[model samples]
Target: MRLLVAFTCLLAGCLAQKPQPCASPALMTGAFTVTTQNEKLEMYCKYEYDALGQRMRVKQQGTYQTKPFTRDYLLLFREGAMYQIFDTNRTCIKSALKDKFHPMEIPKDATLQGQVVLGSPSAPGQGLLVNTWTGDMPDKKGKYLSTVTEFGCIPINNSYQSDEYGWVVVNLYDNVNGIVDPGQLNPPDFCRDTVMKTDEEPKNFLSLFHNLP
Candidate 1:
């Protein structure tokens, strides 16, 4: 099924944070999988590294993910995970995880892995689907990068797409730092492990964090 979507690309500077490398610079290659509580969906990630053991880039693929339609690709990062998400349109998501488990952004000076962790209790703004990763590289212009650090969870700010995936009051939003050119995301990341669930069931992955049941 094809759905018509309205696009509102973020104006270049709308990015509230700096742009860091897509993946980490220490390790060379890695992979991880995140399964839903019910295990009906899975998010797969394959990381790539450069000669210096720096993660040069990464590609992602998944299904039953944000949508049960197609697959997409995302860039790996060092400060956190970076992915161009698609929902009617495309947008970027740059978020980082902290040593302490929080879901909000708080820039600090403590270096857990030789990098500052600017995390939060959750994502920057009101996001319906949020995920933080640091197995990528680091960049100075990136938003998820900072000297001060903290831990935060990705907030799944799904948009008002008529609840196509079984939502009524879906309010979609991108991480303040997530700014990408429309139609620029060659292949967006639709990994279920990184996606935010929006169901009323207590077994939903999103429910575990939203306190929903």
Candidate 2:
């Protein structure tokens, strides 16, 4: 009888454990709101990825330093270039993209914090099941907490804090698979005449927002 009881207890413990980490869809488009210490940015973003080539294009229209502005970013990792388009003046600045291609997935080392429902769980078809995970950033520069859909592993929100950059929270939504328009990744015609600014120091995606005017 004790052996049977022990076996049942072991089975129950295994069943209660969360599944392994899952990666989000490779090609997706989504809208996200990012808030930092003094800036709030709302952006519609498109991401395309493969082993060799990856690109992220973001259309940002928000307030920075209490000033309203609209801008677009094309970060081509494989090409090693980042293009910043100023929508207000139709000007463009090109710089070397310093960040590597990072997939939109929870890290394997992340700890599963637990599961939660976004809405009333008692109401049928009204609640979304999500899993929360936390871990140190790959670079170990900060720590992050993220939530994603339990079924599809779609990211819902993430918050990160670091002494150098302060705190940043991003809420992602309206995510769907596949690229809406392949042409959107291409640099605008107006940007063709704009020369690449190689003299200034290269900045990653997050730091680019910090230095924005």
Candidate 3:
């Protein structure tokens, strides 16, 4: 009986410990560069790889050119050989020249949408209240705040009262820049009357990888 048990355990261990084959696809070639009237940028890029090439690194240097204005972002990538973050360090490269700039909105976590807009310094703490699509308009709803605080809440949270979503946007202050873009980060706002944002859970960095194939 003891021999049979040991044999079963050994088989399970062998099944669980099969070594994974290494992968070393070549680094991607070329940048998908584009320029618009508002902006034109180019990345001079290079590749660095692990012995397996499974781990990858991309070193990119580029200039953000808006006619007379120019700023350079030193970009690097640390993971995901197939589809990677343009800037692994998570720095705001041309934010200073961006249409919107907020030094206070940057966070310890990765910034998304116009730099994770800052909450009013006066706002007691972080919170959220659902209203119209904007979340800032006026209406009657049991308001609640969140402990999970974040950057500024905008017209969606600023100009309007909580729980007001209708044909008219009550709070014109909130510039509802909806939908977060990974490469771009923005400021966030709060307009919930009774609801405060809670630090319920942290945003996931790996979630960005979902966009990758």
Q: Tell me the TM-score of each prediction against the true structure.
A: 0.23, 0.81, 0.18
Candidate 1 minimal-lDDT segment of 10 residues: 1-10
lDDT of 1 by residue, 1-213 (tens): 111111112212223344332321222334434343343344454433332311223334444434433333333323333343555554444333222212222223322223322232133342222223222112232123222111233222211111122222222122233223323322345443454233422121122112211
Measured by C-alpha RMSD in angstroms, how accurate is candidate 3? 23.4
Candidate 1 matches the true fold with a TM-score of: 0.23
For model 2, the run of ten residues with the poorest summed lDDT: 43-52
lDDT of each: 0.30, 0.74, 0.25
Instruction: Estimate candidate 3's alpha-carbon lDDT, on a 0 to 1 scale.
Output: 0.25
Candidate 2 collision pairs: none
Q: Candidate 1 vs candidate 2: which has greater TM-score?
A: 2
Question: Positional deviation of 86 in candidate 1, in angstroms?
Answer: 9.5
Better of 1 and 2 by lDDT: 2
Best by TM-score: 2
Decreasing lDDT order of the candidates:
2, 1, 3
Per candidate, the number of residue pairs that clash is 64, 0, 54
> Stretches of candidate 3 above 4 Å error?
1-39, 50-53, 66-213
lDDT of 1: 0.30
Residue 120 deviation, candidate 1, in Å? 43
